[model samples]
Target: MTQDKTNFTSQQDRLPPQSIEAEEVILGGIMLDPSAMSRISDRLSADAFYINAHKDIYQAALRLYSQGLPTDLLCITNWLSDNGLLFRIGGRNKLASLVDRTVSAVNIDVLADLVMEKYQRRQLILAGTEIVQLGYATETDLPVILDEAEQKVYSIASEHSASDLVHISHALADTFTEIEARHTGKGSPAASSGFYDLDNILGGGFRKGRLYVLAARPSVGKSALAGNLALNVAKTGKMPICVFSLEMSTDEYVQRFLSSESGIENNFLETGNVSDSQWQPLSVAIAQLSEQQIFINDESCPSLNEIRSQVRRISSHYGGVGLVIIDYLQLMALDTDSRVNMAQRVGEISRGLKRLAKDLDVPVLALSQLNREVEHRNDKRPVLSDLKDSGAVEQDSDVVIMLYREEMYNPDTPDRGIAELVVRKQRNGPTGTVKLLFDHQFTRFKNLSRGRSF
Candidate 1:
């Protein structure tokens, strides 16, 4: 029994998942039919073939196809010969054999899919082996090891082939479908900021796969605005909202949300000084908030990789997230050499966040700090150039909303109770300012009155 078990283990270890027949059929089919390459080029790559010789042949054919040449047997042979890979792939006889074995290219697509499945299985096995090695490395921190293991597995699961170009007709069809959905009241492909005028200025609201930078000077209510928007999305959208509170504790953020929802002063909540009448609304707000799907990570100075891993875990658990809000961008940690400048570090962070938004297909609202240069200027309102440490913030973001409260700088100004959300850079829509009522006490923002001046 022991010998049999050892033999079984050895056999399993030697043979990784593969389908040589399917790989051969695909390689042969591409040469047999000139049009077969087009059908599977996007779905299959040379790496998907388990056999090295097949990988070489398929790669040769791909080279031909890329150069606008037909991937017939003769072309593949000549290309492989010119590249000195003909002998490495078993020479011209190997190509002839594949063609002779393949009757037609009818099943090439299905065969390609099978080869890809085998490839993915092999990849998963390799990932598992690496994960096992990671487990044994006690020198590394436990969280780091776990994160590396999860990333290894996640990469395999989320791997995608390079996309092919789509014709305009197909693009138009998708656009019209989305438009029809909105026209029929199904839903818009955006999440409203819960402020009416702001929504209008944002086309509808924050869109999926886009980074929205909310920049302001210190204490200008960017964090408050992000919290409010996150709460609004959690309340309205069916999907969960993730908040990475790099600057504040989760308790602090929850208190602000409670203050906004219950109409209680944030200071009162922080101090546990709620009045008798405030208890009722506070209770109601707590109940409402308890039902909302909002996940907060109050990790201080978390790196981008850590954030991505947490977001992926939360998204996997809750089906998907509607939005991801980073409390403040500057505070997030970046692992880089000491020689790298802060500006370049920040640019890398912004680009990484943009890519994260795209990968998760959710809107990412990142709160940023404006440089003090705005303070020296006559107009305290921030512009794209005021984005601290990086211009990539403006270049990568789809929308840049600068929060300006004149009261912050000039306490006696007419806009004491008003907040201006200057839509400075909008990639897809008009740029303008949307005014809202800023309630300093409750740390909340609301739509301005119809006839209100400031």
Candidate 2:
């Protein structure tokens, strides 16, 4: 036992993965040719250096470059001295030695990549150590522990890998290729919302890596709209759809889908009171829905981490996910302590969903509830400010769509049975109101015909 403990200690004492020579080369090359900083600035940070002194030297050079000044040895020494970090970084002699050893900045890019690789390895090791510590935290819940562990590992893999800047010429070439592909009917950069007017207003459809928020007062059909969108995406059969139903059960959602697809009354389906005539449409609806790839999780008030983990799993299993829909955002849980208030928790949840959309490279349609302030107004139309709990929902979303039903507010109004999808905010397109015919019996919304009357 004593010998094993000694070996373990020795292993732990070994230096973390790093390339000192690469760090020296990068610092030296930057000082030798100040222009080299542009090539490697995005790829490497000062923390990439293994030694503290090397980190300080690189940081000083970064400051000089950012200020539109030369990053020569003398400037670096003066900057370090001015910052009172000269002796901490081994004095002026250290900067002189780095410049003296390097001849050119021709290989600075390669050295920068090598340094980043070492830093990433060290980060992985540290993540593993933290994960081990989490494993020993018996007081924490298992799911929370697992989620934290995954987040730590994921950050090291993704957040640390900075992308190089692409020149406009190269970017234009790729854009042209995409445009040609679209023209040839080979592919599209967006997925259709399955509604003609909505698609037009969305500049095509829901784009990948975007967060779309659908908010409304109670009984205005935001969940129904989300369900409709999900069913449409699933029907495309191009990619799988994942739905997290925090407020509804999987059975209830499926029943709603059946009623919507069959044009039958939702109450009839819920009560299992289908007539002989309705059985045929119900069967056909079931068959059609079964052919599509849709997965649902009905865990009530699931934490954001749980949703993220499940989405990742489904995405991995299905090759890719076309869309992810959360039944409602306000009901989702955030695993936070007592220090976090409700508003802060909701803000974090909103931001986490946005990040999840970007990380998974899929569109996330999150249903939100409008605040009661909308009801107090004479217009009763929700704006971006009506998003409940926190303003972060509007801030984090790339698009915000609010639902309004005149019939709900004014039963005798001429627009009865018509629903208005108010495009309150669109990041890349014009915002306007889209009218759709709503069938409360079937719990569905469809495009309004020009000549049709309620």
Candidate 3:
């Protein structure tokens, strides 16, 4: 029976990735200085420790701290013993040994980091093992299996790097700090869209961690406006902008940008019929644009996962992303079950993009197509209900803007070249309409001047 037991134990052996020493040191540091846990309480989790006993101890300490109780060695040991867990976690002797081995809490940060690193490594190995098994299995479809595998891997990365909740007091402090900076001519809360009137309507600019939806009917130039905004943000040189063009190709967007920046006609550039006088401006525009930190991804139908991954990659390379623009929302591939309705699917995408904006701490400017029902109306201007596929787009967005141009419907009207940017809904400011000049030849939109007429 002893030989059989030994053989069974040997056969069940597995080497899990861990750092037991680091876990012990972190726990010890916490016991040494109760405040040590406060420094990394948000960063560390119970699952971060490889040893079950250490995890339990850390959990207990966290509970005490959260309840405003002491986390000293005596308090923790007594609590553990009273809860009938001291024996399971190796009793008072093991607890004493941890405190004895620790020198100070100064190195807690390094020790906590080591523990987290080992936890992530173990998660990676487990995910990889599951992926290998899936690769060998023939039960599920390959694409489905790969999607699940990617989700598992990305979830681990996200969980370890996610942000913590902030108290309202801290948020208020940040708000007042930004206000003071603006008052002293230092900075604003968000990046300006570069249109004076629109910026004023938006109460400065596109605020951070907001989802701005720009919806318009076909041929009303939502894409053109989006491109103009991207160019304007790039010109600021404050922070970089990333554009995910699920509809337009990179070369196509570049041409539109050139036309807008150089004051050249789009058709003229398309046909290569630019006069010599236009050549200098085109060259200058190209140089200026090339110097700005604008990145474009022309993926035809990217899922939300792909967009998030790309955003992270760009932020890593450029320090951070100032703005993220998706050409139009409908083109984005929904990351949900196919059995769901179109409205529900679009709602999921809208919610996901909003969460992404908050997670990345950048504004997401997503262009969307309005429903065709506006065409039958006498006014012909879009409203909140005109948002296609989902009202959730209207609900989830911090700002919902619709573009309207009367000249498109009535060519004889004197208001030619004038476009209306109707701010139908703004969570933090007033909602109204602002006019701009739409230069169709250049495929650009510009702020309307005081006494200017087309």
Candidate 4:
């Protein structure tokens, strides 16, 4: 009989070692509801005044009504915490009726013996056993829990060798499918800012989830170009856009936009050189701009998380934000812990911008500063190598462009107001030059082509 009992013993019949909490270890090891296990586990880790594994189930019912694992657990905990009750093993009624704390049976052998008289208890264990055995799920209601757990491991895996190729391929294929869907001639209600070369270069206008880096030496009109694009996107009432200015104030950006829209000139606005008649048109343009769906956030040195949070809030308030303009990429701070190289950081930032674009499903236009190497070159036009940092930026970016004007180098050059939009790298299509009209007085870019003009 002793030998028979030994042979018949189950895995859960083995009790946890004394070093670990027996209740928690037993629950964690079993093929039971993971949410139930998680609540018990959490209470032990924390210096909780109390703990009731069923408390989460009860609280989830009280809070979310029909809560499932994870969500149910969180809802119950949050509700209990908010109500001034200790999140512990025993629960209280509305009038604080005491509940006797009963330790869950840790020994499966003991549990089996007890369940022999109560068959319902044994059925509960068998119900979710298949998924636990297969490692497909943590609980019946939390089918995707293991999937998320796997992703967490995969994200930081040091060695993604030959075996990870399948996962990588599927992710790439899904991304390509989404890209193909968006690339197919989708039109917006906004009027195209006239400038055929610029329009052709940008594939129409400042799109969502794209960063158009307008890089230059210290005084090469990075702000001016950014302001121009902001104004252009804003003019299209149909495609709403928002600009986050890290380097400039909202008023400063607005003035630049007005200078571009009203033809009041940047110098005139800064130096207060405008006539009374010019103020009328400027005021009119301001009023017109106010009614448009253009939003500007001028917070300085915002982290990527802050930027994303603001974008989410703005998108939530407005139906959705179509274009997000970051005055410059390098100005933003990385708040997440990263011991990676500077190149890796820049790549991470670049990847994040791309992700934001895909998440929002819109173009992200970000200005960038070119390295001094552009100045060292005989031709001052910016090149791909001059991009601030990282091979990842060049690799992950869908389109890489540089704004260069020869007139910025030599004032005597005949093409004083002409800007060359060099498509240094185009991942999806052809690489070419698109000529744009750069109005020096008013920071604006307009289409030189006949029909594309707004």
In order, the Cα lDDT scores of the candidates are: 0.85, 0.84, 0.84, 0.57
Q: Model 2 misses residue 258 by how many Å?
A: 1.3
Off by over 4 Å in 3: 1-22, 29-43, 103-110, 121-161, 333-342, 450-454
Q: What is the descending lDDT order?
A: 1, 3, 2, 4
Candidate 1, which segments miss by more than 4 Å at Cα? 1-14, 67-104, 134-148, 161-164, 179-185, 273-280, 333-345, 373-378, 389-392, 409-414, 449-454
Weakest 10 consecutive residues, lDDT, candidate 4? 1-10
Q: Show how many residue pairs clash in every candidate, following the order shown.
A: 0, 0, 0, 18
What are the TM-scores, per candidate, against the unseen true structure?
A: 0.82, 0.70, 0.83, 0.57
Compute the lDDT of residue 355 as modeled in candidate 2: 94
- Which is superior by TM-score, 2 or 3? 3
Highest lDDT against the true fold, candidate: 1
Clashing pairs in 3: none
Residues 1-454, candidate 3: write the lDDT tens digits. Answer: 0011111222256656577888888888888889887887877888878777887898889888999887889989988988888988888888899999999899888777777887887777777777777898788866567667777776787777676688999999998998888677577877888888888888777877899999999889998999989888777646888999988899999999999889999999999999999999999999988988888999787778778877876776787788899987887735357798878888888999999899778899999988889999999989999999999999999999999999989999999999999999999899999999999999988889552111
Q: Model 2: C-alpha RMSD to truth?
A: 6.7
| TM-score (C-alpha, index-matched) for candidate 2 | 0.70
Residue-wise lDDT of candidate 1 within 14-113, one digit each (tens)?
A: 7777788888788888888989889998888788777788888888888899989999999999999999988888888999999999999999889988
**Tens digits of per-residue lDDT for model 4 on 1-454?**
0011112124466531122133233322222323344333322222111124433333443344334334323444455667665344344332132111223324533332232222222222333353355465435334244433333333322111213225778889976875565466454322343455566555565555565455566667777776766666556535567788888899898888788778787788988988988989988888887877777888786666556666765675676776787877666634334576567776777788888776555677667777788888798887888887666667767777788888877989998888877888765566788777777777777655565422
**Residues forming the 10-long window of minimal summed lDDT in candidate 1:** 1-10
- lDDT of predicted model 1: 0.85
- On the 0 to 100 scale, the lDDT of residue 307 in model 1 is 81
Please report, as a residue range, the 10-residue window in candidate 3 with the lowest summed lDDT. Answer: 1-10
